[model samples]
Target: MQECLGFYAWQGNWERLFGASFPQTTDQAGVAPLLSRVPVVWFSFDEAGNMTTQNAYANRPKGWEKMVDACRGRGIAVDMTVAYLDGPKLEKILADDSITDRIIAGIEREVALFDGVNIDLEGLGSKSVHQADSRTLVRYNFNRFLNKLRDRLQRLNKRLYVCVHPLNGWFLGYDYREIARLSDGLVVMAYHYGPTPEPYEPVEQSVTLALASGVPQEKLILGILTLKPYEIPETLAEKVGIAQKHRIGGIALWKISFLNEDFQAVLRRLLQIK
Candidate 1:
């Protein structure tokens, strides 16, 4: 099967464009080469849970439209990423039916403008809810929200993508199998295990946990961080080999802003992009 490669780009990381000589210019040509290699790109223009706001996309940075258009022009899917907001606010939002509907509707409006939506909610059960009943309630509410969102996306014919952070202390909250079944795919964040040193054990454990939780290999996209202390070419190759060996969905890099020419070339070769 063909592999799917994705890249995540944050709106705040506009230093390159803002510092460039011609900030007004769209510079589609500058990004075309990188866009050509990835099948999916998730853009975060708003803050966590900001999708519920009316002007969520109003403050989109310069060249945002041009970049999204370029991705679409190449048959690539652009997904709007929304992170989770912790605290009582998140609990209240998930528990309240009316609030949940409003949030989902707001998200749908944004999804209409993009190819899909990516939910990057993290730290599900990290809060101090000691009682077992309270924990169960929290999990139920979260799952309910996901189910409602999935159904709404299906009705709108939009893809639902979610990110599964590595199995750490925060793993108890999420039900990976349920999440996998409710969405198009899961981006398994396999990096950031420690102050990197080319460790593959974390990646392996993540994949194993995801599979054991009933997430099919085809729906699991291994995520790699491209920031400094980057993986050596050999380690990168090993990760790609692992994905290929397991017939996983594909691989995704954490951010495009940190990718350099040398690393990009390595990705192009590993991902088999022409």
Candidate 2:
């Protein structure tokens, strides 16, 4: 199967994603070089579970459409991520049946502008205290929401991707097996443990655990962080090798703005990006 290399570009880092020039010290002219190798780019410009308001894409950066069109022109898939900081909004939406249509309408409107959607519902893990019945309710409602969203995307002929934090499903209360089954794929966020970053051990363990949890390797996408002050080119390279060795679906980097010359060089060499 073909291996996918993906990257995330947040709203704050729109300059790096579409900027014409980059720091010369980074040995990079612009984002063009990186786009050649990356098949998918996830843009986190939409607020999570806030579909009641006007479409977020309407406020996108100037030339946003041109940028997306440029990406598409290169055979790259531009996906938007809908992320929730906490579970209350998501929980509230899941609790109410009447808002489902509105949510679906908002998503459809946004999906029409992109290749697909990535559902990133954070802060809903099992770390919090909840009664057995409440937990079951949350899980059921969340699953229902996903199923509905998946159905909508299917009807539109668009892809649906989900994000899985570093935590295990048992702790997060997310059914990864079912999530993998419901969406096009799952992005396993394997970074952001703490200030003092370790080598590739944490990522390897996370990937291994995800696989053990019944998430198919083929449906898994390993997510790595590219924040500064975490110099571990060798470790990052090793992780890429691991992903390839395991034959997982792909490898996704956290953000494009943090990428420097060294980092870009490493990625270009390992991923063989022209």
Candidate 3:
């Protein structure tokens, strides 16, 4: 069966069937259906990869364990997602081995409360690392970084996954082949074309390109943004069809905090289709 993942964001106050919440509830009776459909919940810790000096234990949001238990109670695997979008800063961290070592150490510490860690370090591959050139070196070093981080997480028996930009997109820092080999899976963020009613061809092309780059379909997870204004059930199902057509490993919703009845309805039907 293809996996279905829902990203549980920490930034939003969600309105649920029980009521709106500041500390959103995932284990509620109303949310059980959505949580049950999702095999995994990617907890957005709002942490960074470039920040090497961090205390993961002390940094958790209040009542983090209970929140995690809520999802785990439903038999869902909860993984932590660490993100860094600053291009220059990420490039610098990738260029220097010492910097990456610290970053990896910091990430390893953060995963103790998680089943796995998904690194979302953006702004590389197509961009320069130390200078205005050398995109190849950026990919080389990133591959090395993933290799090291994967080893560290493996020692802890925690899975390693990378949230990557689409291969057809502008950013080229991710070496899909090497990353596929290093990480357990690749969550391809395949949305954001321009306006509402985004094109699905790009999503299809991204999956195709990833496969062409030698990434196995089983290791690919198509990441779709469910918060878009035009993302109705019809549009959402089209994206799911792309993943189904390609036989990818699974699909990841950008977040579950914004999940309304409409989005949940689409997922219920779409996920069952596969």
In lDDT terms, which candidate is top?
3
Q: List the candidate numbers ranked by lDDT, top first.
A: 3, 2, 1
- Over the stretch 1-274, how does candidate 3's per-residue lDDT look in tens digits? 2567776554341343223464555334334444422322332222243442123311235555665676666676777776667666677777787777877877776678778877777778653333335777878888988899899998999887788888777787778999999988888988787577768788889989999999988989988888767466788889888889989988877776666777777776776521
TM-score of candidate 3 to 2 decimals: 0.84
Best model per TM-score: 3
- Candidates 2 and 3 compared: the better one by TM-score is 3
lDDT (C-alpha, whole model) for all candidates: 0.63, 0.65, 0.70
Clashes of each: 0, 2, 3
Candidate 2 lDDT score at position 244: 83
lDDT of 2: 0.65
Q: How close is candidate 2 to the true structure, as a TM-score?
A: 0.81
Question: Given candidate 1, what's the lDDT at residue 44?
Answer: 27
lDDT of 1 by residue, 34-144 (tens): 442232233322223335322422234455666566556666677777665453556666788777777777787777877677776655555355356676676788789
- For 137-225, candidate 2 gives per-residue lDDT tens digits of 77777788889889989988988878777653334656677888898888887766655454667778888877887888888888777
Weakest 10 consecutive residues, lDDT, candidate 2?
Answer: 21-30
What is the Cα-based lDDT of residue 157 in candidate 2?
90
Give the clash total for candidate 2.
Answer: 2
TM-score of 1: 0.79
